[model samples]
Target: MNLAYQAKRSHLLIGLMSGTSLDGVDAAMVSIDTDEQKNISSVSLKGFHYVPYSDEIRERLMALCSVETARLDELVVAHYAVSEWYAYAVSQLLAATGVSAEQVDAVCTHGQTVWHVADSTPFPGPNGMMPVRASLQIGELSVLAERTGIPVVGNFRARDLAAGGVGAPLVPYADMILFRDAKKGRLLQNIGGIANVTVIPAGAALEQVFAFDTGPGNMVIDEIVMLGTDGRQRFDEGGKIAAAGSVSRELLEPFLADPYYRLAPPKSTGREVYGKAFVEQFTGEARKLGLSFEDTVASATALTALTIAEAYKQFVFPGMQAEEVIVSGGGAYNDTMLDMIRQELPQGIRVTTSARYGIPDDAKEAIAFAILGHETLMGRPSNVPSVTGAARPVVLGNLCF
Candidate 1:
């Protein structure tokens, strides 16, 4: 069945995203309506559910992200395991929403990103010196399609990478549709495992969008909490732990000086830069400096705010006059993180969450992929050349029926 043809009527899509946090799969059931010109005039997120990864499953997936010498066989098994979980999430969504699989237009998933390197790093090449950039998102779409009995669109980044793009921050394209405002210059900031911001000038055209990752979000802070509690806590719930401590500039400056922070826009990053290894090294040095556990977590939380503020000061604010910074993802739930960002940024800017508009902070990313799948089904290009540094705009995602 051709998705585009079926989408001539209203389309309902389920977007699944398991972010670098390795927490769980976020599934959003979105109803979208497109005009004859294939422009999405309206979209509604009818349902949202988060199916958490069991401790064992999360351990396996996190190991895949950072294991010293993970075997290919292990990678293969984890991939299918993730796919089956995604299918389970889809079933759960349908059951909760009272929507049948037969009625769903498609299930679009971003899969689990075990590795993503978007810069010109030199790796072993066929002959000699070659700078290659690559990314891998596992969870077999064919398995998802087979299990769900619905068309699945996965692998949404390869074509963009092949066209010379970073294949990241793909959510900005969806930001244009989901959060753009004609009167207010809005900054859509998603603070997931990795933090990223998309700047949309008031009534800005697609080309005017500016976006890039702002270092670590919940990952570093969460890691510190996990270590502090010996894995008893997955995150710093509501920023209480962070609030209990004081931000240490001495410890925070090193994180700010990281080379990744200085890179300009059209850039992206992941756990590859701010994951377990990075957290362990920073925490080791913090303990060596006699910093308390609370202070260490506080500093990491402040790093997220300071880096985001500095990114805006250097890259975004000068070019785009943002009225409000609307935050999303797991970080939005952290009151301390939000307060730090609000204080670090200029007073003129107001910090809030996507929920103020319509979408919940946690569900925004999943919703974005759902919208992207709808665009792909409509035969419309979804990746912004300026945002992802692609050679040109291209329809993203691979279709599996």
Candidate 2:
């Protein structure tokens, strides 16, 4: 650990995030303030930058994420490659902000989640059967620290998983810090590759907040779009393609029936369940139904929207009184996804993007990990037990000094 960081009341830290989307490394230079009570009194984003992955890197990451394609040697190589990429992103961010590494406290990175298994996943055990809840986030902190000459915090999910938690949706803790409203109940919905919601009741305390992944976000939609475009395009980009096509209930219903959706809160998921293989199955279904490219993309988009509303209604709305859903992540930019969500949502609830509050939809996740990094340095237990089904609260993030 950096001695200077230990003694500071406020520190400038770069938080890094590489989500399931295989998009890019997002770094946010954040200025965070903490009090004697170990609570965040003030937090602000100083600067942010995103460094996209090349086609080759994205392809390797996709292979490593698959059981049939993953190679141990490539996993090791990609791990270091991702760290270098993250270090490069940090340099770019500092240049963009005119800041130096020595002036910063640390780089807190969520790394890249190659594989994640929640508590509900059964595995063979010593004497009987048990749930093997574990997670992996590459981009080694030691490598990052060596490259950047800055204290690094990495592999944040391990601690939570060790404590018998889902090791995901760690952003909810940051959501409480960044989006908690005193007078109004708000839902912070992050529609990244995988969609998740953080339900904050009006004036609710830390313990009252709850969150869970709401099932497929832009992950499925992007996959369908990629297939349709033959890698010519990456995403729907404003929902133009999806808007051009009609939703197919035939295709969307089976996805809604996924067992993961029926699981209660304190749950989470990732590409392991919704990655290449899943996309292949989805494509197969679309072909069997003879759906056009636009209709397939539209169905995938609607699946995301319908499942989000359904999760809120069945699990969240019963106890929490939320007036609006503050959306973030890539899905927020998809007008078609938003429109579908609004149509399915209850009549009184309003939907809006996080841009309305200040954070850009794309930068919100990156900004979140930055806050979590700060909390970790403060010796704060940042994971919400209520949201992750953890046995107890534990300080997340491993330090590479």
How much lDDT does each candidate structure score?
A: 0.89, 0.88
For candidate 1, write residues 1-401 as lDDT tens digits: 66455447688999999999989999999999878776788999999999999989887788888757456888999888799999999999999999999999899999999999898788787898788778999999899999999999988988889889999889998999888899999999999999999989999999998688878889899889999999999999999988999988887776688887888878999988888889988899899889988899989999989998899988987787888999999999999999999988877888999999989999999999998888787777889888889999998989998
The worst-scoring run of ten residues by lDDT in candidate 2 lies at: 1-10
Clashes of 2: 0
RMSD of each: 1.4, 1.5
TM-score, candidate 1, is: 0.97
TM for every model, in the order presented, reads: 0.97, 0.97
Residue 382 displacement in candidate 1 (angstroms): 0.7
Residue pairs whose backbone atoms clash in candidate 2: none
Score candidate 2 by lDDT: 0.88
Off by over 4 Å in 1: 3-7, 67-69, 123-129
